[model samples]
Target: MPLHHYLIVAAALFCTGLAIAITKRHFIGILLGIELMLNAVNINLVAFSRHDPEKLSGQLFALFVIVVAAAEVTVALAIILRVYGRYNTVDPDEVNDLKK
Candidate 1:
């Protein structure tokens, strides 16, 4: 496949993720959107790196991003779990203050 094809797919995925993030009310939904966006970025990175045989910078950067994204999701899920326990809700809009 061509680089442009990958770019188009990534762009679509990114736009979909952005829309999801903006429209979703639930914490998990927002997380899903973020993950989608990250994956789209990874696709772009890999696509760009494929043409270059001398250097693997883009692929390496994508790997680092995946690791970072994993850690971020772990921390975010932990925070979301705590918030749900305290407030009994997963809707971000419902949780305004930290105080009980």
Candidate 2:
């Protein structure tokens, strides 16, 4: 496939993820959107790096992004679980009043 095709797909993914992250009120739904956006970024990184014959920077960056994303998910989920235990809910909007 061509580079433009990859870029287009990445753009679509980013847009969809952005919309989901903005519209979703659930913590898990927001996390899903963040993951989607990260994946889209990885696609773009790898696609652009494919043109370089001497360096693998793009792929390496994508790998780093994956690692970071994993760590972020771990920490975020832990926090969410803790909050759920205390509040019994995962809705972001409903959990705003933290003075309980």
Candidate 3:
């Protein structure tokens, strides 16, 4: 595929992910949106790597991003589980623990 095509796909995925993150009210939904955004970034990195075969930095960074995202999801889900246990809901508006 062309570079522009890859970039456009990446841009679309990023925009959709942003919209989901902004509009979703549930904690898990927000997490899914974040994963989507991260995947979009990975797509871009891989596409760039393919276009420039001389350097593997983009692919390396993409791998790092995937590892980080996995760790983030693990921790975030744990926290979300605790929050749900405490509040019985995952809606962002329902979380008032820090309202003081």
- Cα deviation of 11 in candidate 2 (Å)? 0.3
Task: Report the candidate with higher lDDT, 2 versus 3.
Answer: 2
> Tens-digit lDDT track for model 1 on 36-79?
99999999999999977678998999999999999999999999
Write candidate 2's Cα lDDT for 15-71 as tens digits.
999999999999999999999999999999999898675789999999999999999
Off by over 4 Å in 1: none
Leading candidate by TM-score? 1
In candidate 1 the C-alpha lDDT for residue 61 amounts to 91
Clashes of 3: 0
Model 1 reaches what TM-score against the true structure?
0.97
Q: What is the lDDT of residue 65 in candidate 2?
A: 100
Candidate 2 local Cα displacement, residue 95, angstroms: 1.0
lDDT of 3 by residue, 1-100 (tens): 7898999999999999999999999988899889999999999999999999999999999999999999999999999998888888898798987633
User: Model 2 reaches what TM-score against the true structure?
Assistant: 0.96
Local error of candidate 1 at 11, Å?
0.3
Clashes by residue pair, model 2:
none
Q: What is the TM-score of each candidate against the true structure?
A: 0.97, 0.96, 0.95
lDDT, model 2, position 94: 80
